[model samples]
Target: MTDTSTSSVPESTADATAAEPEATTAEETADGGTERPAADNKDLFRESEIAADYVEGLLDILDYDGDIDELTQGGRPVVEVVGARLQSLVGQRGATLEALQELTRLAVFRQTGTPSRLLLDVGGYRASRRKELAAVAKNAAEKVKQYGEAIKLDPMSAFERKCVHDVINALSGVESESEGVEPSRRIVVRPAS
Candidate 1:
């Protein structure tokens, strides 16, 4: 495990907010994608700090040893916990991880008074799961294209479905959609008309 002392843990939320530099107006990139306003980035960073503190407290209460890192990713606050024996926090099929993420987002919202798209990851579960889901999406897309019929994937969480949809949407000859309700919602890949 890496030394937690050297991690970029935020000292305090106030310090984090106070240290933000003045931001200019959003600028368009060469690719036509607009950069987020610096103040918005600062707010996202603050959300991450608040979430990191909440996770640190939870880890302390649980007597768990892990190194937590907080950062902004894809325009949202992300907190990642890395260390040994952290699988319980991830739980089976990432159910516990999802619940923890929601709680962390709630913590950020309670402090910031705004909804947060905070993503909490434990033991790199999300990164690995994304790879797996991408493969599943590819396989489903291939089957749909080959058979010229819709292929229904097993029920998946919102995050998992999004991963699958992203992969499927990028490929040609096939499209994907979600169906059903929570805990049972699934994706269907079909040949594009």
Candidate 2:
């Protein structure tokens, strides 16, 4: 395990809203100017730290070894666990991993009194899944282009939708959108106008 502290964790532009005022409450300053406390972006970094510690404990308990990388995406911190033969951490259809992600988020929320959107990727499962989703997206784009009709895909997690969106957006003749809520939300590929 790396001895890096939370202070050393890298922050993306989206993660560090340091210049923004706290959204909790409005107050007057000594000069009679209305302002709020500095927003505690620390909570997000805390979330990643707490999540890392949790996953580390899990790995230790399971006698599994992995290198964890902490990062930020779209304003949320993420933890990626990389190791060999760690597919079980991903679970069947990623159900177990999703559940664990929620648990890790909850752990962060409990400590910071703020909800978190942390993403946890185990054993490069997400990278492989991204490739697969990209292929599905490309295929759907082809069908849409050929048929001149929209193609609705199976319900997918937000991650899958993002992968498809990226793929479709990169193509010359297709577009896509997420059309539902979590657990059943999916994407629709359509011919570009």
Candidate 3:
């Protein structure tokens, strides 16, 4: 039987989902048989499919309209929901979006019996946030280089800290480190020397 749920979704979303590689694995199975790498790719795509369905259901329940795109990037499943007037789901600094992403990950885990490194984007929020965080990271790195001292930034999520760390590590005269605990964990930029 064919699934009719996607009938209402936009054609762009359908195309995006179709564009992902089928899942397959490269490891040997318990039966001493080599599994195809395509299996892993298919698994990742399946995770995206599950995540997309969950997110679509959520949008429907909330009376929100969006074009959902499910695809794999950087070896991980990514689901993107794009639409107008969807800011409420994104919340302040995308806190709500983060929560929803975790929920979708859990859903994938429950279905696939494997933990998912799924990334969910709502209303292009993550892309915008990444750009903003990159700028913040550069500024912090600059401050460290100019002051010749350690600079502690405001606490940020793990993803945000990673962004800053990547920027600082790429620079010549500065390094970045994470300190403190969750919700309070932040990045510290220090002179390389």
Instruction: Give per-residue CA lDDT, model 3, range 81-180, as digits (tens).
Output: 9999899988766667767877898999999987677878888887887777778777766766676777767755555555566667678988766655
RMSD in angstroms, all models? 13.9, 14.4, 14.9
What is the C-alpha lDDT profile of model 1 across 1-193, one tens digit per residue? 1111111112111101011112211121111123434447888899999999999999999999999999998777889999999999987777688778878878988998976777789999989988988888887777777778787667666566667777887899997766554444556677897
- Give per-residue CA lDDT, model 2, range 104-188, as digits (tens): 8778778878667677889878788788877787778777888788876775554555566778878998877655443444466
The C-alpha stretches of model 1 lying farther than 4 A from their native spots are: 1-39
lDDT of model 2 at position 154: 71
How do these models rank on TM-score, best leading?
Answer: 1, 3, 2
Better of 2 and 3 by lDDT: 3
For model 2, the superposed segments whose C-alpha errors exceed 4 Å read 1-43, 180-182
- All candidates' lDDT scores? 0.69, 0.64, 0.66
In candidate 2, which residue pairs get closer than 3 Å at backbone N, Cα or C atoms, i.e. clash?
none
Candidate 3, run of 10 with poorest lDDT: 12-21
Question: Which candidate tops lDDT?
Answer: 1
